[model samples]
Target: MEIILEKTTKPFFKKHAGSQALAKERIGAILEREQATGLTKVKLALRQPVAGRPCFELRCNLAKLGSVRVAFILDGQVARI
Candidate 1:
């Protein structure tokens, strides 16, 4: 089975410098753990919002890491879903 992980960047981070890079690193760490658990990095994206404000949503698939499904969002440096 495959699982998808999604993370949304908050409004504040969009205005802060280096937030995108930080988000990438933070998300990378999560992906690394998934890889260690036998999952493959299938797909990823940094989404743009349609209205209100702009945000990023990263989507990844974990087909090799059992049947567990996980999704999360990032608020600044915090991870939530």
Candidate 2:
């Protein structure tokens, strides 16, 4: 399996100094977890404020599955499995 990370996702990972392997692992984990929940595809967005705030959004295929718009932050990293 393969996953494509959007351009918007890059900055977050870069900011965190995340390694490629770590990013791949995190993404793969999410994909596997989602698949176990009967979802074939998912879209995830992560945003972190310069002042140390974090937020995230997750969607399954185009339908909103989870929205943590301003509650939680995500480290930009993605994988597929």
Candidate 3:
């Protein structure tokens, strides 16, 4: 699976993450883990479809940043964050 960050994700990180780089790194780590294990470690909740593809909310907790939640839609082998 591939992770693709959406445009709004930058502002989201600016507001909720202490370090945007770290947050992105975390997302990359999640991607790596998922690709390796074929399992999602972060909290994922199924949501309504967007453009006919199923959506999901991925929740991550940053040590000093509290919980950061991002909604994404899956299209083929890519996840649009």
lDDT, candidate 3, 30-77, per-residue tens: 655554675465444565567786666666665576677766665656
lDDT of 1 by residue, 1-81 (tens): 122223343443455545445444555666556446644443332355323333333353323322322344333434433
Candidate 1 vs candidate 3: which has greater TM-score? 3
TM-score of 3: 0.56
- For model 1 the TM-score comes to 0.29
How many residue pairs clash in all the candidates, one count each?
1, 4, 0
* Number of the candidate with higher lDDT, 2 or 3: 3
Order the candidate numbers by TM-score, best to worst: 3, 2, 1
Name the runs in model 2 displaced over 4 angstroms.
40-81
lDDT (C-alpha) at residue 41 in model 3: 55
Best by TM-score: 3
- Off-target runs (Cα >4 Å) in candidate 1 are 1-18, 40-81
Stronger candidate by TM-score (2 vs 3): 3
Clashing pairs in 3: none
Go through the candidates in order and give the C-alpha RMSD of each one to the true structure.
Answer: 12.8, 12.0, 3.5
lDDT of 1: 0.41
lDDT of each: 0.41, 0.42, 0.65
